[model samples]
Target chain A: MASETKLSHTTALILHALDAGLVYGFSVMEMTGLPSGTVYPALRRLERDELICSQWERQSIADAEQRPARKYYKLTVAGRATLEASRRRYPLLERLIPTVEAKQV
Target chain B: MTARVDMVVRAFQRGFLSCISLLVPSGQRAEWRREWQAELWHVRRACAPAGAVSWQAEREVTAFCLGAFQDALCLRLHAPKNEPRIALLHGSALQCLLFLGGVLAASYGLTLLLPGVRVESHPERYQVRSGLIMIQDEAYSNDWVAATIPVERFRDWETTRQRYFDGLAFYRIGEQAVSAGSHGTGGWEVAEASKNLFSLLGLPVRFASQEGEADAGLPQAILSDAVWKREFGGDPRVVGSVLRVGGRDVRIAGVAAEGGWRLPGKADVWLLERDSEIAAGGRGHVVAHLTNQGRSEMWASYVHIDAYSPDEPGDNLCGFSFEERTRGPWGIYQFTVLLAFLALPAITTVSMGEYSVSSHRPSWSRRLCRWGYMGAKIALLLPIVYFLSLDVAYWHTTLYSLASEYAQLAASFSICLFGLRWALLDQRQRCPVCLRHVTNPARVGLASRTFLAWNGTELMCTAGHTLLHVPGLPTSWFSTQRWLYLDTSWEFLFTGSGVG
Candidate 1:
């Protein structure tokens, strides 16, 4: 049902960022150049609409890194199908956000 | 920058986010706050890494924290409404009782604003002055409406009956063309009474006095409250003005207080007359103050006009017969409400279905709570019917008219019967244990298959306590609605939603 509906540009950006391995809310905001307010709420909507899913990283991992545990997002199967449809609707979406490996390298 | 300044700036950013968290709904506030706080930590680290203080980086963090307010606002706006609180008030037992109490309180408050209805509800204030009796001719003794003693007979009785009475006041109810100052002439009901009538009755003067006393002029007139409002536009200036009644210019003394207890007839104006010849010429109702012996004699005799006999002990002929002619408005309302409640079972089913003492039966406390709720609804409804009926009866008129009493009776019966019927029907639809109205009705089986099997609408208690089967048609096997208790095995159906 959620896959059938059209995704907004900001929502599609967050979904595309999640698909490209920019998983955390801050990473999505950085990649999309959207503010923290726009990225976080759009991520929440995608998660609620079942286009994306979220889980907190292990507390030990955050303690090893000496920072708070980050909530990471991953695209569901339905979300990947919806992203394919959104990619057709907004052709510049893939060019808008780069892959995590590409940005790091 | 100093360490304290950096610490203060970091604290302000976190404090702003904390304030924004309040906008989110309480159920999801903690998770929403944690998510935002975690992201904020990462953002601050990326902006100013390695314990460095950069103004641009601090400004970016501040702007990042401000975005939380919008996110928090969006979550708050989209949060599901508090469904349980709304369901608790919709058709719940507590809501029914509250609605009845609210309307009852409003009706009582309205009665305080209406003088006629207030006096009717509390009849002690309008009790006819003690020792006051009306005397009439023998021909008109049985009928107070047509009962009047000729002025000559009253004059003859005045000279002969000084030993039997203290004072006598005569009032003739008639209609005369009246005009006040610039107000046009209209036919107004007038009570032509002797100048000493107010004093003779030993009644306190209630009219508002301005220029002089109510008895300043020889032939002054006092306007009834209805007439004062209708003809004079309720002006205080009209008190001192002249009013022409039947081609005679009479000074307006003052306006009478609003009252439902007008004796003889409902008059708009009391035209006081100084000329004894004119007052003593016409036939009119005479009120006489009776001494102790006169009172004893009046009560002891049934026929006092042409023949006085001490045979009757219970009947009094010359007392306030006009009030006794009909049950007052409040009396009629009380009787009608009682009759309506008595006839309630005939109109609708009164029995709350019988409960069985099985393993599935509710606890004794739960049963007591259900009965107590039913009793509270009925207790609140009684006064609601009373005050609302009187409110409808006396809202428009200042006097007790027969039509208003009839309206009160109709309102009383209609409101009481229908209100109680709805209350019972609502109770039947509610779950006995939790007192919440059952929801999600689904039809089971065809209506034509009722003879072969149970065919009715099945409704489940939202709390998963029981299922209600209301037959589409009442048969011998399913004469009334039945409640089927859901056992512990069925608890899985209500798991995640927190019902059972």
Candidate 2:
């Protein structure tokens, strides 16, 4: 049940972040107000499942300011298609509620 | 909030310890740490339940997240029961070998497509003393007949002069041809005659013969294609025109194609008759003649000396020999063969070396072994290929020779591919040498204690004899440095003690 919930939210956030140019964890957090706790683990699960792909940025000015480095993520070709299909299947309200609730506390 | 912090700390610790157990080698330690931290952070957020905003609820959620994180971490840290070994098909060395093999095959294919002709002539004489003189003898009975043939008629002649010149035909001789010596007279006469005959036949003969005494005594000259183009500007009307040569007016009797004469190096001017005496008597002359079938032959003949010395009380004095001289075409073939052989090995060696170096990292012993193997393979194949190529080339079936050349190149390429793969992957290890994490170590010195287990086994086996001393000494001495040294000395001191 936890994994199923995680799979759905992670997929939704990845799609939303990708569309918003929130291609990395910090950017996703800034865009969606999701804590590092929610965003990164979802990103990893999405990557492991082949729904999204991530690559470590060789040099990051923001990372240098914060820590050593950060990995950038993007929707794979399959992920983009899946997101489009899922958007057609679910009502806009249903998708927004879970994301909003996940973001809120 | 405190409970959540405590849970987060526990999750982080578990993940960190799992990573440590996996023994993230020094080179990748930093990356593993970052990945673990990120994972811990994500686990906390994702596993947090829908809440009524209580500290106890938050604590319960965090602890649950920690437990989940530990389970995942433990799974990752444990080695798989069926860990995948590197496959021959997927290895990087294999990929490189495939790429190199394709390139070499393409190159060998391209070499076959180049257009060029390889000519063969038997006893193929390259340098000739007298090409035109030989032609005259081959054409007529003697120098007298060649001389009297009227230089205008001789221009129609076509001869193949491989070692000498090609397509030479005499046209005319000047009045002073009688004064030039045997060497000069016959060649000059032939040159003039060939020029005149080609002109009369309306064929292209580039050079004209000089008429006046000023030019006549010097030499009879035939014009080259370049000179013809320069002097006549490629004018067809200039065939019968007179030109100045050696300070005398000479008549152009014919035009010649520059390709006709196979002069040793460069030949622009051919003298008709340099000595008048030889021209008159036709003694001691050589000439080249080509049959209609394109085969060339040389003839050395003499003219009746009595014809020139008619006033003297003459006996039959044809003061020259009629001998057929033949030399085989072995020299040129040998030279080309030597060049091909010498160049092949050097090129192959370089290609093999390049393949070896690029495919694998440098290791002295491995490289040496691969080099030796490739060298032996090539050495065994070269002589057979060379002789086979020669036999094919001899029959003028050089297409087969070309094919064999390509095959040799292909074999060389294949050898290079295999050699490179063998060289590169020969000693690669599955784990990092110094830290014991999954890695490929090129050097043994860089291996860590865990990776050093194999080498340690070898050392122990080599010193197994030292474990027993006089059959009764304490085995503890094997592990101690001082006792071990004493034991080693005792074995050496008593060679007949049956340690073997």
Candidate 3:
């Protein structure tokens, strides 16, 4: 079944990337074509009000060239509940929303 | 969920910590910083989530929130560590308080240890400017013998009696009266009959020799200590120096010690009995002797002349008994003591009232303790001040009385000091409830009906409020209370508080 959730254009893009596990700031920015200014500040505000949380990922490959430490943002329980509530309020938008692509753009 | 909650809680903790900086001024920024940092640590622990995710995100959220809250809350953008920094800024104020405390301690210590403070007592030197009379004459006995002569006639003496004799005045004599022409009777009867007449003229009878010879010559002269010392250098040589006194030569038989009389220090030269009789008629001689001796004997049988001149009559010129003289001087002492005693309690109540008014703003316990301390201080200080005031009053009355101007001036100064102490104490210990100045009725009534009803004038009451340091209020209240207690106690013991 298609996921019955619809977000705003920017929100939708952010959510789509987070759901696919491409949650780091750089990864989200690269996938959604959003600038660092728009992504970073929004991430911070969301995290502040309990809607989101961010953390650094542990490096798995010791030899991998060190990429700038990426902060991974994820929806909190309250944020998930809000997403669900919004889906119920706008069922028609949920139906017309496009599916998130699995591959990185 | 719990981990996310913990993170949010840590963020809010940082915000709250940062908010404290807003409460203090920029100068106190360092103090606020330390205070808030400690406070935030407590808050973070209290808000820590109970799960694995909480452990993972707590530190990051804490740091990030700390930065964000600092930015939002700090008014001055350039300021760093605003909350923590402000918490450390109390160094100067604390130092100032410590300095003041040290100074107070040192002053208190010095006051306790120092004996340099002089205890009030009788003045050593009396300025003699009033209450003195001088008689410039000489006298002789009825036998027509040159019994005494003025110092101006020293060359006429039969011998160098001045080398071994001093002059003297006679006021009284006692012997059985003998009718005229009695047989085998000695000259004692003559001396006895003349005693009453001489006493009425304020004069004293003197023995011509140690053998109490009734027929001895009457010498009349008084010498001051200063003259005696200058002439004899305090040696025995001057005791018998034959010198002219009041133009009559007299033997300096003996030296009279200083301060032998109550008269002001003015009379030093005396005339002989023969010279006195010559200058003043027999009637005048008798009258002068009676007056000089304070007229203590029968006046009807003796000669009596007014000691005061017709134009200027001095106080108590009429002969007064020792008791009567005491009464006059004692009146002044009584008045001083009365004022001092009354002022004592009045001053205490006012001072307490002032303290209460000023200290009301402190914590309840602190205020109560402060009031108690002030009360104790007043109580402790009262006896000291009372003794001091009494001493001052007594000396001023007895010693300064020699100089009317000095005596009056001293009396005035004492009264003014008592009044000033009263006003001051009233200002210091003000009532807590009324918040009015202790001495001022419009702001704070000086006399309360309830207080008066309870005979509270004797007992100091805390009443309305604590004392305040603000201007236009009594600044001397505390000191006044201390002085009042002392003055009152002293007056009670020394003067007797029948009036207060």
User: What do the candidate models score in CA lDDT, each in turn?
Assistant: 0.75, 0.39, 0.38
TM-score of each: 0.61, 0.26, 0.29
Q: In every candidate, what fraction of the native interface contacts is reproduced?
A: 0.86, 0.00, 0.00
Off by over 4 Å in 3: A1-105, B1-215, B218-220, B271-278, B281-334, B340-401, B404-416, B419-500
For candidate 3, the docking band is incorrect
lDDT of candidate 2 over B347-430, digit per residue (tens): 333221111112223357645654554454344333333333333333333222324334434444444444433433331211
Question: What TM-score does candidate 1 get on C-alpha atoms?
Answer: 0.61
Candidate 1 chain B, run of 10 with poorest lDDT: B307-316
Q: Model 3, B267-354: lDDT tens per residue?
A: 3333335432433212221112223333334233222223322344521212212222222323444554566656565544433332
Kindly list the per-residue Cα lDDT of model 1 for residues B1-500, writing each as its tens digit.
Answer: 67788899999988888899999989889888898899888888899898898778889999999889888888888888888667547756777777778888898899889876876764543445566667766556666656465665555555554655787777887889987657888898888886667665544444545553554554678888777888778777777677888888777877665563446577888887753544555578887777777667665423264423234233233544323434466667678778887988988788666444458778899989998988888888888888888888888876767667778889888988888888798888888887878889999999888899888898988777878888899888787888777777877887754443
Q: Best candidate per lDDT, number? A: 1
TM-score of chain A, every prediction, order shown: 0.89, 0.63, 0.60
DockQ (0 to 1) for model 3: 0.02
Candidate 1's DockQ is 0.64
Decreasing TM-score order of the candidates: 1, 3, 2
C-alpha DockQ of every model: 0.64, 0.04, 0.02
How accurate locally is residue B169 in candidate 2, as Cα lDDT from 0 to 100? Answer: 38
Cα RMSD, model 2: 22.7
Error of 1 at B32 (Å): 4.5
